[model samples]
Target chain A: MTSSNETVSREIQLAARPQGAPKDSDFTLVERQLGQPGEGEVLVRNLFLTVDPYMRGRMNDVKSYTPPFALNETMTGGAVGEVITSNADGLKAGDLVLHDAGWRTHALIPAKTARKVDLLPSISPSAYLGILGMPGLTAYAGLLEVAAFKEGDVVFVSGAAGAVGSVVGQIARLKGAGRVIGSAGSADKVAHLTEKLGFDTAFNYKDGPVSTLLKEAAPDGIDVYFDNVGGDHLEAALFAFNPFGRAALCGAISQYNATEPASAPRNLALAIGKQLTLKGFIVSSYSHLSAQFAKEVGGWIASGELHYDETVVEGIENMPGAFMGLLDGKNTGKMVVKL
Target chain B: MTSSNETVSREIQLAARPQGAPKDSDFTLVERQLGQPGEGEVLVRNLFLTVDPYMRGRMNDVKSYTPPFALNETMTGGAVGEVITSNADGLKAGDLVLHDAGWRTHALIPAKTARKVDLLPSISPSAYLGILGMPGLTAYAGLLEVAAFKEGDVVFVSGAAGAVGSVVGQIARLKGAGRVIGSAGSADKVAHLTEKLGFDTAFNYKDGPVSTLLKEAAPDGIDVYFDNVGGDHLEAALFAFNPFGRAALCGAISQYNATEPASAPRNLALAIGKQLTLKGFIVSSYSHLSAQFAKEVGGWIASGELHYDETVVEGIENMPGAFMGLLDGKNTGKMVVKL
Candidate 1:
């Protein structure tokens, strides 16, 4: 498909606001006719569409860090695509680009808003949507910058097998963390975290109380925590933290789908005696670290010091299922839809 | 009382560890034989004893920032006293001093551990136990350093009529805060916070839910929070916080005496979207700021630009009752026992 008037694009739209957990009927697939790129715009065919946990927040018609996805309109997110035509300087046809126009088969984006990428054989275009992308940067900045991770500091990360947590554990291990502990939802993911991801210890949070499991894993206490799954995991981290402990709160996947308010982590008062620092942040705030992150993380990937996994759901129609599955912890790492 | 070998001192001892809220039976007044100053020691007669909320934490038999008060022993805390005799190089008779040896009418302490103070007609020695002492430094460091308070930022503080919170609100106002909001338990304390302490707005927490009261008090949202009373107050601050808000978790007076765990502030997950930073700290960790705090807060007091109130309980026999009253919000500003 090129930037011709005959080209057609299939996009997913929010059919209804989800009450509890989103179902198939909450989304509607629509096909729209494509037109040629206008001035300072480019037409691209999306190769991979990113399905992230944060997307669930956009599904609701509520004010947030990002605007809510309009009902019956194409929902937008990160996508890696091959540009078919460009009407702007410095961008050309056949160039691969990364942009936020996903949940669709194609995108017509402003040239300035689309970032051109190098096509490498060792890495896939989808890597831009996972490791070496937002999730990877989230981990890098959340650990090194936000959490103030230090050498020989014991590091604990929840959602250990997910995209951000996987990167966080590996980076801590590579950067000489005294110990790295991870918590996942499944035994397979727990095994993957310890065996493949080089976490010093891994536990399935579903097995028992998170506080008990975390205390058993990190007997000496953790100095830094990279929180991806909130709720009990955060409360447990609070219990397992040593004096002056730091936690970078990135996401709360456990509470994302809840219709009722979150009620766990009641032990937040423990922070006082322990003198803990809990900082919550969005990855977008640390865009200044993108270059440094790419260089360091890219080097780790190239040298095989870091590893990443992708659970790809083929076809644009399965994007919603992939996203819902991602939230349900069905994916081991980054969940993406290949169109 | 003047450092005689035959002098007797009246002291209060912790008879038993209280299960919940401490009572009169938990303490016992004792008569102890006093001795003259030994080598490098000073014998001081107590003038005032501080009764603070943190004493509640020390009453519980648990490992914490401060050790629990040993059973059947004289309880120790901040005291301002006048030295009668000294056996150290720079010591002299009739010198007023500050030391950590309260719950007693007299103290025999090392001269190095006792800080001599100027007996100013404008300020009483008791000011060293309240506005010009540990509580003063706590408010200064927690607001300016821990919370990273900035000029023109909206500031909200819980327990705003207490020693720490009153100072926190006044300092913020003096330093050009855009707005200052305070919460106290009683209507009188609320009125005192707004009318006397210069808080732009004040609310009695007993009026309604803290979140609703806070939202009404700070309509534009708070940029900084100095939390003295945690639990629901923290949850309310979380809801009233603007993006990138910072909270200094100094104390959790609300949950200190609770036999069970705290359950409020369940909405801490909101920190992620708001990009909030909550840091819990102890005043001892910030002793490096003592000189600066003294210079600033002392100047504010001397210039009459800042005002402080103290609820003084007569006699050392009422010390335990004063401490219990402090926890119950029976007094405004600092609660001290005048001996």
Candidate 2:
């Protein structure tokens, strides 16, 4: 029998390389003993975990900006947890922290790897995984820096109901974009983007071809495109972009889980005539902007200038399901697994 | 009977729109009577006319940076002519002038529109069509200004034996590019690029695949790509670009005559990860740089540092064939019709 003071942690490991959309068999839930925090490590009891589109790229065994997840090892991502035991300086028990040890109930993380979070009653800890976290910074830097957003620009964003794109649309509006348009997979998500997120117009991509929908919604043509879902959305943006248009290619969620390589955008030749610019980026590449992003967006949240939504799962065992659901367009905004 | 003092002009008019490549029937050489020069106009006897790739875009009934060539009207392009009768104070007869009145043996042009060329004993007037004219400014602006070429950059130029690409390669080298690679259609053009143009390496694209050939030529990858031919060559540039690589998209000659819409570059997605920048430009957009370009490149020409080639097609009636030959890549550098 286990002693009352002896803690056992449950974790999920990558069981197999996913061929397409990840199935339940791709992840395995394993229970292990918390060996004890040593040296600069801390024993973290995870409170919340993040399930994101970018994680899909890590599942494939290919070299990219980041390395693929090692098969049969514990998968990693963004998470919020409490320190149960600390062997490192500047960290103590009962301290809430943000870390990158995902899909786990507890973690023994290096103190330097975990950042202390000052808990607030108004803001949820999981916000660090969504609007106030990596996703938020991605929206900020991608729109302003990568795409070179100008005031009064008509901006269009794909995956507008998701964590990053939702913030992208909102920030564009707040930053004085003349009009903001968005595309989502479902009608409810479309409604949320236009009604709640203040997008000038929103379309359910499943209703019709994106090229037709984009042309109808943004008749004057878009100046900036924040591309999250690639494939047809990218092609549509190419068709709808005006001269000197810019695209911040933050993600290609639509093609991430695809088994076969995606098709080329047939209309990209228009870019030559229009003088368009497209720049791709991962959020981690702009970590230095975190403090500035947090200060500005955090103010937006606190002042009711910005609103965000969350779909939370209750257990760590459901983490894989939440991730798969995100890829399937099941989440309206941020997807969080509350352990 | 016509008076011996009068000049009868032979002009090539766009008789019909071609379904694919322009045919002989698409052009009609008609004789026109000329009247005395008006208050601000000059009577010009055309000497040499330029046939270029961009003219193909103007042949179609589409709105672009420049106006389309009207059916049954005389075609317009770069030309060097003698001012036959000048009624304006600034100009005089016997002066060689440059104007946009191509495909004609003589022209009645506005005096303000015709820029008198200061005769240089060292440089041919046709050099204004190939190197000292719009094509020259296109290469300079596309390479240095548009692509933001930097010293030590490994540059790759497509259509390298052509007027624009040959100049692009030479300019990049003179600007201190680490390596200058070029691609052409024939082995003779390839040898011309490497041997005459001083390209670090040159390849005949017909030898094999552009992707394989480009990788073999620039194993270290390219920092700047001057895209004159867009197709497999553009796709190859995307594949061969290093991080932060820049491409000055000058023209898409390869896709200009395509019956159907051109297909997109398949690996354009790689741009996101590599942080590549591709910018398209038309020469007219940078017309302000002409005097500055002329001052610099004209010196290069006068000093014999810049060597240029021309395929001269004699007679105004052969203008159509010369343009067709340019589309066919029969010309090594600039294709000009001497009327």
* Root-mean-square deviation of every model: 1.9, 2.1
How does model 1 do on interface RMSD, in angstroms? 0.9
DockQ metric, candidate 2: 0.55
lDDT of 2 by residue, A100-126 (tens): 988889998889999999865599999
Docking quality class, candidate 1: high
Q: Who wins the DockQ comparison?
A: 1
Clashing pairs in 1: none
RMSD of 1: 1.9
lDDT of 2 by residue, B1-339 (tens): 577656799999999987789999999999988777889989998889999998998898986667899999998988999998999989999999999988899899899998988877866789889898888999999998989999999999999989899899998888899999999999999999989989999999999989999999999999999998887898899989998899888888888888876664767767776777878777877888888898888888778788788999999988899999999899988888887
TM-score of candidate 1 on Cα atoms, chains taken together: 0.98
* Candidate 1 wrongly placed segments (more than 4 Å): A1-4, B1-4
lDDT of 1 by residue, B1-339 (tens): 555365578999999888788999999999998788889999999999999899888888888888999999999999999888788778788888999999999998899999989865589888998889999999999999999999999999999999989999999999999999999999899889888888999999999999999999988999999999998999999998999999999999898889887887878888998999999999999999999998898889989999999999999888889988998999898989999
Which prediction has the highest lDDT against the true structure?
A: 1
**lDDT scores of the candidates, listed in order:** 0.92, 0.89
Stretches of model 2 off by over 4 angstroms after superposition? A1-7, B1-6
